[model samples]
Target: MDVTTPPASGDGPGTAPADFTAAASPGTVTLAWTAPATGRETAEYELYVNGRPTTVIQFGAGAVPSGRVEHRLTVAEPTGTAWAVKLRARLPDGNWGSFSAERRITLVA
Candidate 1:
């Protein structure tokens, strides 16, 4: 996980994480993004894989610009498979921001 560099910050209230990226390695995929302004206010990040709600990322979601986040997952699917990913954050106070622009990655060895 790399947080030393800041990605794009919030465009405005209710905005999604900034500069979301996904990178594929032999058997794992790494996802990273810059948190939103309200990230620290109590939010759960939802990871979507292939357009389905996959899991809730335990890492903080709205950590501001300096709280860039990175998560890696092991891939069990076959190589050359296509992985489409998206992210959105849900706040305990009833705020579900928009989903981050989708990122695509092809699995490789």
Candidate 2:
């Protein structure tokens, strides 16, 4: 079992399709993503915002408990700025997969 990051833009045999979903609630942004085809079992999902990584959530196979990796990111105070949510998968062997498409969303006050 080989674990690797997702391929760079225009750099993979096939473009792995990933889903970036966001749900705005009273005080948090529920973010999620679909799994990517990395030829290996994924162990977790890493989330990044703006240009910095925020957190890495653990995932278990069949534990599809939620099926999707979710992040409950909080807003300090709803600033009118666009935030980029990027996702990456971790292989069961401990290798980080490539990042999925960047999803940008704005917070309206």
Q: Give candidate 2 regions above 4 Å deviation.
A: 1-17, 23-25, 38-41, 60-70
Report clash pairs, candidate 1: 39-62, 40-62
Candidate 2 local lDDT, 10-106, one digit each (tens):
7553222277787666557788766766665456777788878988766566664343556676776565667887777766556676777787777
lDDT of 1: 0.79
| lDDT computed for candidate 2 | 0.67
Q: Find the 10 residues in a row with the least total lDDT in model 2.
A: 8-17
C-alpha RMSD by candidate, in order: 11.3, 7.5
Clashes of each: 2, 5
Alpha-carbon deviation at 88 in model 1, angstroms = 0.6
Off by over 4 Å in 1: 1-11, 39-43, 60-66
How far is 77's C-alpha from truth in model 2 (Å)?
A: 3.8
Candidate 2 colliding pairs: 5-97, 5-98, 6-97, 6-98, 64-67
Which is the leading candidate under TM-score?
A: 1
What's the residue-level lDDT of 33 in candidate 2? 68
